[model samples]
Target: MTAMASVISKITAKNQVTVPKQVRQALGLKEHDQLRWIAKDDGSIEVKKANNNDFWGVVMEQQRRYGSINTPEPAWGPDVGGEVID
Candidate 1:
């Protein structure tokens, strides 16, 4: 019989997330299965399926945003609040 299922995972108070049982079985994933998170152009996070040994196997490209940010930049230069040492 074929095995496959769809489910949603929730993050815990400790910033930990658990994969549903059905999904784990379908993806052949067990505890400690390595996964990677990516930020899209809209700043939305996407979770992609990956192999444990392939954590750094794939290189992610930079996303470009179409609009300008309305936030102001911090004025923390090289001399913020520390002493200067030449």
Candidate 2:
């Protein structure tokens, strides 16, 4: 993980790609671990380990900074129509 590494994994007919063992070890990933895929403008993909606590922390930070409205649960409100395109 310290040094740069590259790995390849084939997409199955079901569109599922098995995480390469080396990459899994580098990411400290285990079975059932959630992953987040980010598509960059440069046509490359970034994979990250998804942690619920990290996600909630981000929402809490956003609420703290932007000030949440009075509701049973904090809501960010209406979507402004930003959409992702391939």
Candidate 3:
């Protein structure tokens, strides 16, 4: 196994930091790619590539912490709606 080199990046005044070239290549990150910052119980932070299908992870976490979200039924019915004509 090849040893990974440590790289450091400085956070700018706007709170943005550029991912190092080596790190970006290793993670297969491209322009406009999304990353998720996860805070661990050990006071450490982890950065991982964000997947579009991971939205359920957020919903499940919210449900576990604060119970499922309650959404109210629509106030208006189809009969009272301004139906669009095709």
- What is candidate 2's lDDT per residue for 1-86, written digit by digit as tens? 47667677899999999998887888889989978798999999988887757878678867999998566966889988989899
- Winner by TM-score between candidate 2 and candidate 1: 2
Local distance difference test scores for all models: 0.63, 0.83, 0.83
Best by TM-score: 3
Local lDDT at 61 for model 1: 19
lDDT of 3 at 62: 74
Model 3 segments more than 4 A misplaced: 1-3, 58-69, 77-86
In model 1, the clashing pairs are: none
lDDT of 2: 0.83
TM-score of 2: 0.58
Clashes of each: 0, 0, 0
Candidate 2: stretches off by over 4 Å: 55-86
Stretch of 10 with least lDDT, candidate 1: 58-67
lDDT of 3 at 5: 84
- For model 1, how does the per-residue alpha-carbon lDDT over 13-69 read when each residue is reduced to its tens digit? 999988776756666776666666888999898665665454334322111333434
